[model samples]
Target chain A: MPIGFRAFALAGTLFAATLPAFSGTLDEVRKRGNLVCGVSMGLLGFSEQKPDGSWTGFDVDFCRALAAVIFDDPKKVTFQPLSALDRFDALKAGKIDILSRNSTWTLEREAGLGLLFAGVNFYDGQGFMIRRDNKAVSALELNRTRVCVQAGTTNAQGASEFFSTNSITAELKTFPDGPSTLRGFETGECDVMTADNSGLFAERLRLARASEAVILPDIVSKEPLGPVVRNDDVRWYTLVRWVNFALINAEELGVTSSNVTEAKRSTKPDVRRFVGVDGADLGPKLGVTADWAARAVAAVGNYGEIYDRNVGSKSRLGIPRGLNQLWTEGGILYAPPIR
Target chain B: MMVSAYPALLIRVGIPAILVLLLGGCGTTIDEGVVTPGALTERPATIRNEQLIGKWGVASYRDEKDRKRVEAQARAQCRLPYIIAKGPSDGVMMHLADDAKLYELRIKGGSDGKTYLGPEAPPGEWQDREILSVTDREMIMRFVDPEVHGRYGTFIYVRCPG
Candidate 1:
C-alpha cells in the first residue's frame, strides 16, 4: 500500500478502538429496585422542590410516569436535582438512570453529547425581560449592553445569535445557573437576563418588584426539553419513551387521575385495556406488569393530571398547558398509541 | 390575495421567534409578597376586573363564548366581584384581560404562581404614551407616541359594580 493509504488505515483502526463500550442500561434498571431520575434543582413551573424537599413539577411527573410503567408504582423513583451544567454530565456519567430534567434537545446536544433524548415533553421558547424604565423597547435597541445568561445552555447561544441576527452586539456575562443569572440582572451587572420562557416566568418571582420588568414581544429559540439517557442503554430508552407515550395516550383517551378508577370500570375496550382492567401482553412488551400504566395513573396521574397538580394554574408553579396541551385540543402534544 | 396558513413561515421563522420570546431574560418583580406595592404576587389570591364582575350583555369581547357565558351568569348570581376560578392547565388559556396599564389575564393552572407586570403602566408588552380610555362594557387602549402607535380596541369587561 502507498504511504497515504497506510496512514488512513491506521487512523481507522485507532478510531475503531476509541469507541466506548456499550451496556444494556434498560436491563440493569429492570434489575435494580428503583429508577433514578434526574430533575432540575428548581425551575418554578416546569420543575420545583416542594417545601418538604419532595420534587414536584411537570418534568418530575415524567419520571414518575416512567417508574409507574417499569415497577407499577410511580412513587418508586428517586429524584436527583441537578444544575444546568451538571444535567447532561450526570447522565453521561450514569449518576441517574434517566435525566428527566428540562433539557433542550438541540442538534449540537444530540451529536456532541453522548446521550439520547427520549422525546419532547414541553415545547418552549426564549424571550427578553427588560426594566420598563430602560426604555429598551426591543432587542434591536439593546446595543453595547451587558446580558446575563446561563452557561452550558442554549440561552447563551441564543443571546449571541439574537444580537448578531439583529446586527446588534451585547457584552456577555455568564452565570453558572439560572438563580445566579437572575441575581446578576438585578444587581445591574448586566442589562438583560435570558433563559427558557417557562423559566423566565418562574424567575420573575424573586424580583424586588414585579412591575419593574417587562418581557419583550419577540421569542428566539425552539427548546424541546425532555427525558435523556445514556446512549448505551437502548432498553431503558424504550421503557422511558413508551411510558411517555402511555401518558399522552391516556390524556388523548380522556382518562385522568381523578377518574382513573372509574376508567377501570370503563366499558370502553381501549380504556379497559389501558387501565389494566383488560388487555393483552402489553406489559410484557416493556418488561413491566400489565397494570403498570394504571399504577402510574393511580400513584401520580396522567400527563394532564400531572400538569394540573404540579405546574397547573392552581399549583404554586402556575404553568399554562400552552403547547404542552393534547393534540385533540389543538395543541401539539401528540403521542403514538401505546397499543 | 389572502395567504394560506403560514406553515412554512411559522416553522421556518415563527418557531424561532416564539422561542426567542420564551427564552427572554430576567426581570425584577413589579409586585411581589404579601403587601408589596406593584407586587403581582401580592394581588388578591384571585383577580377579576372589579368593575365587570356581573352578568351583562355580551358584545365585541375577548373571552370565548362558553367560558364567558358561565362567567356572566356567575356574576349575575354571585353579585359583583364574581369568582371564575381558572380551570386546570390542560386546555385553552382563556385570556381574562390584557390591559393597557395592567394586563390581568387568567389562564388554566392548578395554582397561581408568580407573575410579572410588564414595565409600562397601560399594559400590553408594547409601550404607549397617549392612550387612555375605559368603559364598563368595553374600552379602547392605544398609544400615539411616534415610537409606539397601536390600538387595542373594544375590549369587553362586564359590570360588577359593588
Candidate 2:
C-alpha cells in the first residue's frame, strides 16, 4: 500500500495540472511557486529558446513580464512550448497559468470555450506572401495562383475565403505545420503562402533567399493575438489583462526598463501613479503586490521595449506596430487607463 | 488637479467630434470649419512658434522590421542622437538616425490637447499624424492614416538630452 499511495498522489498532481482554469489560478500558481506559461514551439521572434536553454521573444518576454509582477523575477516563468492546436487545450486544462503563444483571440475561443482574451498584444492579420518577381500587386492579382497553407489553422480557411471572395481560382497546398508549409513554399510547390503576416515574415527568413519573398501589403482577416486565461477567475483575468495594459501604458508614458528607476522617481503625477510610486495599492487588489507593475517593467521593460527587442525593429521578425499601436497613435492599440 | 482629468475629457470631447465629422461628411468643403480628426483647416506656411519645436529622442517605434535594429541603424546615420526637431517655416524636422536624412513634417495643435504632424501640405491636403501626447520632455504620436495605423502603432518620443 505504500507504493500504491505514492502512485495515486503522483497521478493526482498530474491530473490537477490538466484541469480547467477554475477557482484560483493565482493560488495554484503561487503554491506551485512558479507561473507556468504556454508558449509556441519556437516561432522565432514571437517565442524561441536559445541554445543556452533560455527563452527569448515577444511572447516569452510577455510571460516574463507576468512572472516579474508575480515573483519579482522574470526567471520564475516556466515556458512550456506548445503547438498552435495544443496551446488552447493546455490553457483550458490548467497545464499553464497563461497562454502567451501568438494565439488569435477569436469570439469562439473566448465566448464558447470559457476562455477570456485579456487584450490584443499583437494585432495580426492573414496575408499572402509571394515571390517578388511574380508581379502580383495585390491578393486580387493572385488569380489561379498555387498557394501553400498550413493545415488545421485559420490561415487555410482564410486563404480559401480570400480566393473565393476575390473570385480567384487558387490551388491550396495544405501542409501539416508551419515548417512544412515554408518548405513547400521554398521549393515552389506553391506560388503563394498564407498565414498571419508575422508568421509569413518569420517563415520567409527560413527560405533560401529571404528577399525573394514579399508579403503583400493587403491583410484579409483580423487576428488579435494576446494572452488568455480562463473566465472562471475574474481577479486573475483582471491581473493578466492589466499586465498587458501596463506594458502598453508604460510605453505610452515613455517608461522603459532602462529608465524605470528614473520613472519611479518622476515628479509627474501620472508617471508616479503608473510606475506605482504614488498609486493606490493595486497589487493587493490583483492578489499580488502594489509594486507588481514596477517589478514587471523593471524585469522585461515596457511593451514597446519588449516589442522592439523581440519582434519589432530590433529582432529578426521586425513586425511593425501597425494595428497593435495605441489608439492615440495611428494604430488601434488603445488600452484602458490604469486608474 | 484638473490635469489628471485630461484623458477622460479628451475621450468625452473627441468621440462626439469624431462622430459629428463622420456623419456630416459627404464632400463637405474644408472652408465649412469641418473639424475633422486630422484635417486641420488652418495650414501654416512655416513652423513658426509651435509646441513641437525641439529635438526628440526615439523612445519606441514599430514597423515591419525589428525596431531596435532600426533604431541602431538610425543612430548610425545621425550626427547627434536620434531626434525630431521643429524648424521655422520647415515644420517639424526629423533626422533619420543613419543617413541623417531630414524629413520636414507639418504640425498643428488641436483644442483637444492633441497635435497633428505630417508632410508639409495645406490643411486636409494630406493625411497628417496625430500627436497624442506631448509634455515638457515626452511626445507620443501616430499617423492619422488608417493604413499606416494598421501597420505601425503610435510612436513615443522623449525630449533629447541637452
Candidate 3:
C-alpha cells in the first residue's frame, strides 16, 4: 500500500469509527489536542481565574481530573470561561469538551437541551437574603419586597414559584448576570439577590462591609450541579464520569494530592486497586492506560481533597463538606464500585 | 555588628502577635490564654460587628429609604459546618443524605437559579440557641436572646451563581 493510500485509509477508518459522534465533542476534542472545558466566568470557589490567569475552584479541579484521565496529565486541560447563559450553547456546539461550572441538574437542561449531566459534584439549593436592619424574618413577611435574580436561570422561574406558592406578592428584578445582580443588591436597588450558595460567598467578599447582608431560610429549589458534556459520547462521558468518581472515591479512601504517592504504598487491596498498585486495571477499561486512575490521583488527590482545597473548610472559600461528604462518612457521596 | 538572633526572635514573636491583633477582631474574641487544633475545634463559629456578609440580592424590597433593590450579594463569611447537611456532633457527614446535620438553617441560592449559602447558626456560649430555619438561599437565626445579644437575630444570604 502506498503511503498516501495508507494515510487515506487511516482517516477513513477514524471517520467511520466516529460517525455517530460526528459534529460532536468526542471527535473535535481528540483532533484539537486538548480537552476544552467550560467553567464559570469567575466564581471564586467553584470556578474563578486567579490573578495570574490560572483557573482555580471545585469546578476547575473537576476539569483537571477529567484531563488527567485523558492525557495522563491533568494540566492538559484548557479552561474556557463561560457565562451563565453561554455555557450550554458552547457545549452544544462542541466549542467545549465539558461544562463543569456550578450549573444545576434540571429536567429541562437534561432532556430539553442536548446535554447530559455526569454526576452531582455539589448539592445546593435556593434561598433568600436581606439586610439585618430589616425585621423581615421570612420571605413570607415581604409584602412588597423587590427580588433580584438572573434573567435566564432557574432562579427566575423559582422566584415566581416561591412567591406564588406562599401567596406573597412582590416586585421581581432580574439582572443580566451575577455581578450586576450583586451590585444592585449592594446599592440597595434590590431587596433580595438569589443564586447558588457558593456564588454568594464569593460575591460577598467584594462587599465594603460583610455585615449588611443576611441570607434567608427558604430553599425553594434544588440545584444538583455537575459536569455536562454533549450527548452520545459514552467514551468521553465514562472518562469524565469516572474521573469524578475517582476524586470522590479518593476522598473517601483518604488519598490526597499532598500524600497520595506515599499512601499508594498501602498493603490494602482496595487502596492498591484504587491507586493502580494492585492488579486492578480500571484505567484501561476507560480507554486510557491502567495507570489513568493513578495519574488522576497524583494530579488532584481525591474528591475530599478537591473539595477541602477548593471549597472545603480550609480554603479561602472555606465551605464545609456538608452533603458532599462520602456516604461512609455520613454524607451523600456514593459512586459505583471500581470493579 | 548588628547581626543577631535578637532580630530573628523579635520577628518570630512580633509577627504572630500582630497577626493575632489584626485577625483577632475578625473572629470571635478568645481568652488569649490557650491555642491548639483541639481548641479550634471547641470554638464556636461567630459573626462580628458591622462586618457584613453579602446580602441576599434577589428580590425587590422597599427599604425605609424607599429604595427598591434586589438582593444579590448576601454571602457566608465564616468557615462552613456553620450551616450543615449533618449535625455538629456527627462531625462532617459523608453521605449527601444526612440533612440531620443541621449545620445550616438553609444556605441555598433560590430557583431563579441563584446559588447562595442558605442559612447556618452554630451554637456558642454567646450564640443563639435556636438557629430558627435554613434554606438553600438564606438563613433565619436568632442569637441567645434580646438580653443576651446572641439570640433572636437572623442572617439571610444569597450565593452568586458562578
User: Per-candidate TM vs. native?
Assistant: 0.55, 0.60, 0.57
Q: Write the per-residue lDDT of candidate 1 for residues B21-51, one digit (tens) a residue.
A: 5443212223431222232232322223342
Q: Per-residue alpha-carbon lDDT of model 1 for A172-239, expressed as tens digits?
A: 89999878999998888988877777777667657986557766655678888889886765767777
Tell me how each candidate scores on DockQ against the true complex. Answer: 0.02, 0.01, 0.01
Model 1 local distance difference test score: 0.63
Q: Give the range where candidate 1 chain A is weakest over 10 consecutive residues by summed lDDT.
A: A1-10
The true-versus-predicted C-alpha distance at residue A50 of model 2, in Å, is 2.6
Residue-level lDDT of model 3, residues A1-339, one tens digit each, is 122332243343344343443433444555666778899887767777867777777888888877776776777778999988898877765567799998888889879886789888898777677777878877788668888888888788888888898898878899998878888888999877777666665666567765577766555677788999766577777777888887787777777777777767888776788877775567777767766776787887688777767776556555556567789886788987666
Full candidate order by TM-score, most accurate first: 2, 3, 1
Residue B160, candidate 3: Cα error in Å is 66
> Residue A207 error for model 2, in Å?
1.4
lDDT by residue for model 2 over A1-339, one digit each (tens)? 122332244343444444453356677677778888999988778787877888888889898999898888899988999987888776766667899988888889988887899988998899889998999888899998899999998888998988898899999999998888988988989999999888787788688888788888788999889999877778889999999999998988888888988987899877888877776576677888877887889998998888777777666666777777778887887777776
lDDT of each: 0.63, 0.74, 0.62
Segments in model 3 whose C-alpha atoms lie over 4 Å from true places = A1-33, A84-86, A132-153, A163-184, A187-192, A216-218, A328-330, B1-162
